[model samples]
Target: MAYATLEALIKQYGLDAVLLVADRDQDGDIDADVVEDALTAATSEIDSYVGVKHRLPLPQVPDVLVRVCGDIALYRMSSEGGQLTEDKRQRYEDAVDYLKRVAAGTASLGLATPPEQETSGDAWFEAQPVRFGRLL
Candidate 1:
């Protein structure tokens, strides 16, 4: 599953705003279809880099991922814009780092495995919680 969708992006940023940034022409013209294609590319790139297969849908999507997708599309549409500020670049880099961390967190969660495999036999007993008081 894609981490982000065009509709969600549109909802996050108003249609006019998203179009202005994402549209290459920037003529106050917006094409949902073209914008969607850019979103698809961004999603694919994110998934590929994060080492997450696009087939499994994440239970919860992160807002940062959505923001990254929008940023990526806007950057591409800006005609090799040399005017991007250092802060924007820093934020983009930070977003990518956060994405990697999220992917790592999911990997640790082991969500891809079956429910039964979440805990098996001695695995649960290996690290039992400490108990201070006995029940009556």
Candidate 2:
């Protein structure tokens, strides 16, 4: 499944905003093909970072990935036309920074890692009630 969908992009940034970036053909509507290409590129960029710590083609698309993908795809679309806005560039940079942290194991996707892929050793601890030194 795609990390982010066109519908989600429209919902997050509004249809007008999506059209402004994605309507490359200027057909008075969002050019879904253009959006799809941007999304595909964004997904590949994310996979490059995430694949380092997690399996490729993640079984489930995390919500955070959805937002990051949207940011990246929109930025790519805007950049292609030299219409890149400060906000779009900032969002794209933030998404990449977050992905880098995830790849470095400093952040988490909140998914349970497989036992075999877990890097830290299992830990267990037991505690006993304290004993009184003196009793009345």
Candidate 3:
């Protein structure tokens, strides 16, 4: 589920801007599904890349993520116009890089709850290669 709403996107990015980017058909009104698809794609990409597994937008999302989601939304929208500007591409790249550090345990998620570890005990032993010399 996406943490940010369309209203938030509109408010943060400007309704006219968002509508302009999202209204593919130039029908004047922003397509709700287009907005949703971009949001979903952004969330999925970020969550997966950050090792958040499969969930997105997170329940109590962090501020960085919120902004990243917005950036990703805009990035995805830019696909329609062809050729993403370096600055725009860098915006999402920076956010993804930060998340990469978080996923690597080098950085933090700030106030949001961190992604839970799902490792079981004795993973090394469990992964030991089978011996072929002697049989019981």
Error of 2 at 78 (Å): 0.4
What lDDT is reached at residue 125 by model 3? Answer: 24
Candidates 1 and 3 compared: the better one by lDDT is 3
TM-score of 3: 0.71
Which order, best to worst by TM-score? 2, 3, 1
Clashing pairs in 1: 1-54
lDDT of 2 by residue, 61-135 (tens): 999999999999999999996789999999999999999999998999887664545756776345787786757
lDDT of each: 0.59, 0.89, 0.73
Residues 6-34, candidate 1: write the lDDT tens digits. 77767865786566655555566666666
Error of 1 at 45 (Å): 1.9
lDDT of 1 at 123: 40
Runs off by more than 4 Å, candidate 3: 52-59, 111-136
- The C-alpha local distance difference test score for the whole of candidate 3 amounts to 0.73
Model 2 clash pairs? none
| TM-scores for candidates 1 onward, in order | 0.53, 0.84, 0.71
After superposition of all CA atoms, the RMSD between model 1 and the true structure is 10.5
Tell me the deviation in Å of residue 126 in model 2: 33
